[model samples]
Target: MVLSQNEFLPRAESTLARLEGAVLDALSHHGKPSVSSLAGVFRQEARLSPSQLAQALCPGPLSPIGFAALVMRELLAPVDVVLEGSVSEARVVTGNARAPSSLRVTCPLIVLGDLEVEGVLEDCGPDSTVVVLGRCTAWGLQTSGNFLVLGDLVVRDVIQGVYNDESLVVAGDLTTRFLDENDHDVTCYGEVHAEHHLENGRSGDAAVTLASTFLRPELWNVDLGELHHDALFERIQEGEPVFTDAPQAPQVREPDAPTAEELEGLDIEGIAAQASTNARAKDVVYAQRKTGEVWLMRPGSLPLHIFDGKQLLGQGTPPALDVKQRASERVTFWRKRGDLFLEIERFGAVVQLHAGQNNGSLRTFRFAFATPDDAAQEVRRLEARYTGDFLRVTSMIPGRGPLERELANYGGPKTEYTSAIVDGTTLVTRDGERQRFDDEASALSALEDWLAGKRQAGFDLKILEWKPYGLLG
Candidate 1:
């Protein structure tokens, strides 16, 4: 009888408009209708019946999303509001103001000024957690489940979106500089950045994985990693060792760069042994973050964990090498469906692979600890398939250079930490061609490749995005 949170959002939006209009008329009449037509449309306009609108939209023991995430923690985690001691206007100042979205904590969530959120934002409620410590502002921040911020929830400025299975954090620094935009599907479990754009507008395919999103075309569906920082590859090319390069400034110097005799016999020491690796990547990618706990991923993955049933969250490694490409290098190994993958040097962030023999057994590919930009920002929240398009990778300011070395460097297509497949092509770099494609549902099918100079005649494709460590390699 405590029914509040705006009276359960108009009775869960009228039971989600009568369960989305009787599940779209029983899937458009293929028909399986009887729950008595979802209980006669919730007893005609929510009078309630037909099994109380099918247990209030499928609620077993009070479940309409666990009773609206327990009435959003009994009405906004005790928020009363009215600051001005340091500043106010719905400002959610916090020392510990009841934030715990799965505890990681460090400090940073300081709003300092300007905020105006109304509904949503419990940080994905469920035990209702949040780990912010300083710097967190709001013009918008909506949530329902699982919110975990550690520091720098800086809008410096504006936002507006955050639905929720939940996770938005900033351990050390993530300055949107002045926001106004950066919604890339609004799902960061951790590590997001902005100097200019992470996603303020062309949000694009989003399902994100930004450790740095200055935005250009750094879209996502899954697996996006960045560390030293490159802002998330953007050049759009797909098909033929995935190409893009040519937006320089990650480090600065141009007047005519390229000359150790044009970078000496290529592979420049395997790009300096993958920029001396150890930025972290020894096969991670795991899910199911609770109970025994798991969230260990680095070379990236995550779109929503689909249903958030959340499981797995294992595997972990990748860190030793650094002494500059282990001394000597030439990486670009290959193996598609059988397993084993490699395509570093230019093609980056495609870790481990493995997995191939499931039903018949034989799938190991381990790596027990090391990939964590907050487990590689949970790979944007799962769900991604690839084939073509992308040449993105940018930088303009003190941002960075050496093409940000694909953040940690791995290379695409060749999944298997959980999903399958292996080997997805990787090679061709002079500047970093963020993307290239032929077809695979045009997000560039995990960076395609078959080569033959990508059948060039006059070929001129473009799709590059750039920043936090947002994405690269």
Candidate 2:
């Protein structure tokens, strides 16, 4: 009757326990037991091959009790052992079977038909033949011969002959004198070194001339006839000239703004003064001659008063000067039929007042000023009044004069891209165009279409996350 792995496990355990006791008794009676003798007895009694038994009792120094424990562990270790020439039909082996304690096939473990071992195979003798019609793994395989793995083969240590079909993965270095015939494709995660040459299967001619070709082809691709050790050393010591296809030019970068000391030598203030004269101070419409104060006039009787640098200094009536005589004298004041006009030519300041209107009424007064030191001070005061901080001005309505230009030097509002979460359902594109969706299905469909379009255009799309929210009634 065929027994399942579950039923066979208990019998295997009981048999190993009995074998351990018998091996221990033999060791005690023989003083220093010979490995070959003990191995021979175990093979006869347990039906294990010499290679399998030898591997179980590894070459090392250990007490008789310790040795027995090691032997028992190796025997009871989880593995699918097909006794000598027992596998006549196809068999599939699975699960992780690792290293010295795992699998042990007695004779040449031949797979005549098809066989699949998913886990591992280790420590097979040189004479043993493992022929798998399907895929298999050899975690620590040690063998050489008519070995054919039809599917993917992951192996380490000596392997010869055709690896047949599918890919062959080498875990460690693949060291061989030559690859006589390798029909299947191979990808080694580690290095591949050959003492001789690597040849193609068809011509059997050398494919690689030197082993260093696997490392650096440019340095090692010299003709063998032209290569001389002494000459090569002399040339290297003399620093051989390297030739290139094109000479690379050094990159030029824009110089950083000059330091304060370097700027001090420049007439930056003079240039600014000239530029300011051409740019009018739109916000500064009125100035007090005595206090050097400025005001923002906005179609009102009492102007929004400001002091040096556009700072809010409060409001007041025009200076009490003799308007009629000053108008006649043309000394900054003019009067016509109860109306008043004043102009401070030094600061380019202008102000006008109409009679019979409330002092704060919007239609009662008109005021303006041109760009000058006093006028610039007034502009700064106005900026301070508008933005709270003297440095920032949101709109260009006030004219980007010297004050605004200074603010520009300090920079402006910073914008950065960040992943935005959608409380409901929404779709957003790379260009910032957004569409709102009432349901998740529609949003997902639109997102899929957008991803497909992006993929066709050679874009790699990554969906960060999708979170669903439910509404409670």
Candidate 3:
């Protein structure tokens, strides 16, 4: 039942409307706001039950961001307590402000302007919230409650949320050195630039950048995905580099082999060492150094995997190949899809195997192999694994491989669903009818009433998944 800020906003407004005029007035105070104080107002004036008050406050499970938005919009906005210029250690602020070096807030704070902090910011006690309307600059932000930034967020060091349900929402760009979700929900509306980002357990994000990545930038060649969270954390804390130089082959030219003098100050040895350790090294036929650069090439390859002294750059079509060995090594495999048998095709080092049909749909799986016999053996393994019509769970190799997941829809259109906020109140019927409320408040009221009835009918509804419908528009 815990909804996002947008969904909960209308519902919160609707809940507040049921309160007595005296209770509403008492809750709307210009002084510092705390959840306990407002709850007392509801208990004393409106006589709302414990469950009722808790529902009004949070609606679902504990969410810091949702709770913060509820308090700000419902309890605090009516009063005028806006401060100007630089302020610190206050519950309400406008203009520039600085948080204490090591501050633990038990009350809700609203920052109307930019807030800068070179220390730790954490929230303790139930319903602690921090709302920054402008830019936020921090050395580290470790929050247990909700933290919402309407503008950009620049964390010089790290940003972490303690629990999975703890909410962190940044409306603009977020720049940080390291981000550990710690199983929390982090939503970034704009771009994210982080040197190291870790999504431990259920924690994740929908960021344009590689937000949920745990790989270290310094150890760019190593894939630490196989390591457990604890091991990864320990390694990172110990400052242990994960990469070692790949064993050199005689055919592979040394970046310093006479060509090192061509590009002075360039780390050719370093680049060559790193390139030899990349995930795509299996497909790399050879590495050739030109003036000012080095090329990692495959058979009939483009200038995709080019190294410019510092790092690998510009991955173009048929990636991980240079133009030298364009027609060197080729592997092929035959694929049968019902009555149609297709000839094998090799694009660079990738070998595509057409697996049998599933649910009357043509399906194919790709694997990289150095020889045709190796490719054929993989095809036989694929055939042996398919019973054609059996459903069961089995273990798979880990990492971001498709085989790791249940083979539900081998290669169909994929759509990812996440928590999203819509503009208006959302309504759906048991018969699949889509409805919307005229206003935000009305939408929330209706949905709450409907859910209450469903609960009474003996259904346990923990989370609600919402999908957009044409009629809703």
What's model 1's lDDT at 130? 31
Model 3 CA deviation exceeding 4 Å by range: 1-90, 125-127, 200-473
Q: What's the candidate order when arranged by decreasing lDDT?
A: 3, 2, 1
Write model 3 residue lDDT over 1-473, tens digit each, in one string: 12234443455556555643322322232223234434433533444422233335441223332233444443332333323322233255434566544455655566556777645556642466566756888656676766667678897656766776556777678898777676677767678897767665532222212422334433221222222333333343344543233422212112212232444555545655565544243332223333344434333332224454345643333324222322222222221111111112233554443322111222333446676567566545534433231121111111211110011222326632112122345554443444577875564455445434443433322212222231211
Candidate 2 C-alpha lDDT tens digits along 368-471: 45534554455444334433211231111111111000000112254222222222366654345477888755654555455344434433311122222211
Give the lDDT of residue 227 in candidate 3. 25
lDDT of 2 at 275: 29
> What Cα-based lDDT does every candidate model obtain?
0.27, 0.32, 0.43
* Cα-based TM-score, every candidate: 0.21, 0.18, 0.30
Q: Give the TM-score of candidate 3.
A: 0.30
TM-score of 1: 0.21
Angstrom error at residue 93, model 2: 7.5
> Number of backbone collisions per candidate, in order?
112, 7, 8
